[model samples]
Target: VRTVVDLGGVTFMDSSGLGAIIATYRSAQDSNGWIRIAAPTEPVLRVMQIIGLDTIIDCYPSSEQALNAAEQ
Candidate 1:
């Protein structure tokens, strides 16, 4: 269940959204899978960085990079 979440169009994100991603991450982990975030808007990326979510999940500058990494 490798996942690449494309956030290019997402301009905003709050705790709830973050929580959902966390939950999904946990679920993926439980299944020996992984999740990655890609192309998050600056503000959203800042929020993630402030919360240290960037350390928990890999982030990429583009969805193609994320998906490509998943393949590897």
Candidate 2:
């Protein structure tokens, strides 16, 4: 199975959102699955970068890219 978090429409994100993503990531990892983050808005992207999530997370440039990754 695969999981994808589409962030294209999101305008902003706080620590709560970050927390939820991290929790979901952990859950997916534990279950032998993974999540791909897609199309984060500039604001959200900045936050992810600031917190170093960008490096560790599988963040895609677009939703299609993320989906393709899941298929592979």
Candidate 3:
């Protein structure tokens, strides 16, 4: 399964939130699935970048793009 997390509606997130995303990412990896972020808010983007997840995980401006990437 390919999961697209739409961050467009997310206004805020903290360390715990980041942890959850990482955990979910691992779960997907283990299950041979995938997860992607879509349209992350500026604050969330900063945190993701700081954690270096931006380099490992695919982030797209829209869910459509993420899903397309997943297919490839």
Candidate 4:
């Protein structure tokens, strides 16, 4: 199983979003699933990078890429 998160058009994110993503990732890992983020805006990407999520989550240049990666 796989989950793709879309961050496009998201100009800002708070701890809630971060926590949600973290929880989702953990859940996926527990279930032997993969998770990815797609097309995050610059600001969102920066936040993810700063929080070390960029290294943890599979990030793609576009949603299609993410979806394809997940499918694979």
Candidate 5:
């Protein structure tokens, strides 16, 4: 269950949104799967970086890159 979330059009996100992602990430890990986030806006990216989400999950500049990484 490899997932790649596209955030190219997302401008804002709150704790609930972050929680959803974290939940999915945990689920993926539990299933021997993975998740990636792509094209996050500056604000969202900053929040993720501040909270170290980027360290735990892979983030890419584009969905294509994310999917490519998932392939490898």
Candidate 6:
């Protein structure tokens, strides 16, 4: 299974959001699934980078691309 999280509408994200994403990633891994972020706003992307999440999670330019990658 795969999950695509859309962050285009998000204006900002704090530690809580990062934590939630990490938890989801862990859960997906445990379930033999994958999780990716799609079109995150600049602010959110910056936060992810600061926390080193960008290197771990698959970040796509768009949700469609993420979904397609998950299928493969």
Clashes (backbone N, CA, C under 3 Å), per candidate, total: 0, 0, 0, 0, 0, 0
Identify the superior model by lDDT, candidate 2 or candidate 6.
Answer: 6
Cα displacement (angstroms), candidate 6, residue 3, comes to 0.9
Backbone clash pairs in model 3 (N, Cα, C under 3 Å; residues 3+ apart or in different chains), count: 0
Residue-by-residue lDDT tens digits, candidate 2, 1-72:
367899999999999999999998889888988888999999999999999998878899898999898888
Model 4 Cα lDDT, one tens digit per residue, 1-72: 478888888999989999999999999999999889999999999999999999999899999999887776
Question: Per-model C-alpha lDDT, please?
Answer: 0.94, 0.90, 0.88, 0.90, 0.94, 0.91
lDDT of 2 at 27: 90
* TM-score between candidate 3 and the true structure: 0.90
| Model 6 / residue 23 / CA error / Å | 0.5
- Candidate 3 all-Cα RMSD: 1.1
Which candidate ranks first by TM-score, i.e. highest?
5
Ranked candidates (TM-score, high to low): 5, 1, 6, 4, 2, 3
Candidate 6: misplaced stretches above 4 Å? none
Query: How do the residues 3-61 of candidate 5 rate in per-residue lDDT, one tens digit apiece?
Result: 99999999998999999999999999999999999999999999999999999999999
Clash count, candidate 4: 0
Please write out the lDDT profile of model 6 over residues 1-72, one tens digit for every residue: 468999989989988988889999999999999899999999899989988899999899899999998888
Q: Decide which is better by TM-score, 5 or 6.
A: 5
What is the model-wide C-alpha lDDT for candidate 1? 0.94
State the displacement of the C-alpha of residue 6, model 1, in Å, after optimal TM-score superposition: 0.6
Off by over 4 Å in 1: none
Best by lDDT: 5
RMSD each, Å: 0.7, 1.1, 1.1, 1.0, 0.6, 0.9
**Tens digits of per-residue lDDT for model 1 on 1-72?**
678889999999989999999999999999999999999999999999999999999999999999899889
